[model samples]
Target: MTTGALPTQTLPELPRHDHGGCINKAIQIAETLCNDRGVRLTPIRRKVLELVWESHRAVKAYDLLDRIKPLETSAKPATVYRALDFLIEQGLIHRVESLNAFIGCNCSDHQHELLLLICNRCQEVEERPALEVMNAVAKEIAEAGFHVHRKAIEIHGLCAQCAALELVR
Candidate 1:
């Protein structure tokens, strides 16, 4: 992470509330986005998207394959990978490079940069739109005569719950 180029504005911490509605809302958004983009949300892709939204935590590719295998007897690694790739390309999900996993995109704003926060203790992941951060980085990159095609920041730390637990001790 570059210091001088990054924006200083802080975003509100993700809420530790029920995420059932979040999952449902994400699915609806995915459907609309895919349709608008003239992409097919095939059964495999839809299921994979659902699995990715199963939690607020990032899910590894193999883990997703294992889960889907039981349902589809002929499921293969390539099948799940392709579905994951499509979802990512559609902005319905994000790939956490550091974790080699995928998580549902919590933001609906198109073309906005995302910042992922991972809680080490609980493995909870939060996705946020950090436009200011993106702009600052873009400016720096442009100054260097380079264009940023895409960028995402992944930060690992304890969430409020886990941090509070540590404080009590």
Candidate 2:
């Protein structure tokens, strides 16, 4: 984890890579956004974001709590939940409904439809900003007489690398 200001990772760069650089970029964006909105990026909140972006896989709140204990001795379930809520509200992270876990947002520049390509074999997730698809879905939902709110779509399958590995074996 970074001890000071976080690094910046551009949107175009997040999809095909997972490393310390990507996490740092996300943290920097979150920090800037919070600052712009006059929201406090508390230590706990920052830590929660860091933990969520530790890998491409989504992280459960309880698992986040367990990880926080060593750094924040007094950390509780509620505390972690609050941090998760804050991150979600800020668009710094997203909750995976199917998996019941959270993953860092790849596109924090603006609100758009997020499509997560989840690799079943490796548990890796890649974020795709699909505005056109989201708009079409919204139209269909409206035709059904339902109002729209937040949008997240998850498609589960093997990523290219994993699929290739399977073919090899």
Candidate 3:
């Protein structure tokens, strides 16, 4: 419950980086978490998670269904949605409400409040532990006697890499 604001930060995968490591790390974490929680990460669910982690960009449900169909020929809209719902419940992924899309949660090893920085140009989504901002919002909710089941702040803009590219143009 530390309430310190984070300084402005850049997307960790920006510019140029080896993204294959990202996929591997995320999958490994998901497997460990599932085993620790005694929850079964079924084949379909694992596939959906892999597809979502294919990039940092937010992915829509239908898009996920489409991508998964080739691998999981039995996949349907309902199948994808169910897997998504489970992933969100387990804190393995997040729904970007404004964008109506989903993004993999990098901090799935622990529970935390997050802020999503979405780049309009590159369609990449970065997750941040914006503790101070979430604390403020919690205080406001308490004052209003409101109960929040879930909370995430999403801000859309150009990520550092995209902004630098803009300058060059």
**Is 2 or 3 the stronger prediction by lDDT?**
3
Worst 10 residues of 3 by lDDT: 1-10
Residue-wise C-alpha lDDT for candidate 2, range 1-169, written one tens digit per residue: 2222122231112245558898989989988899999999999999999999988877778878888999999988898899899999888998887778888985767575788887666666788878788889889998999866767898988778767866987
TM-score of each: 0.85, 0.86, 0.87
- State in Å the error of residue 146, model 2: 1.1
Q: Spell out the clash pairs found in candidate 1.
A: none
Best by lDDT: 3
Task: Please state every model's RMSD to the true fold in angstroms.
Answer: 7.4, 8.6, 7.5
User: lDDT: which is higher, 1 or 2?
Assistant: 2
lDDT comparing candidate 3 with the true structure? 0.82
lDDT ranking from best to worst? 3, 2, 1
Question: On a 0 to 100 scale, what is the lDDT of residue 7 in model 1?
Answer: 22
Clashing pairs in 2: 9-25
lDDT of 1: 0.79
Q: Please report how far candidate 1 places residue 165 from its true position, in Å.
A: 1.4
Residue pairs with clashing backbones, model 3: none
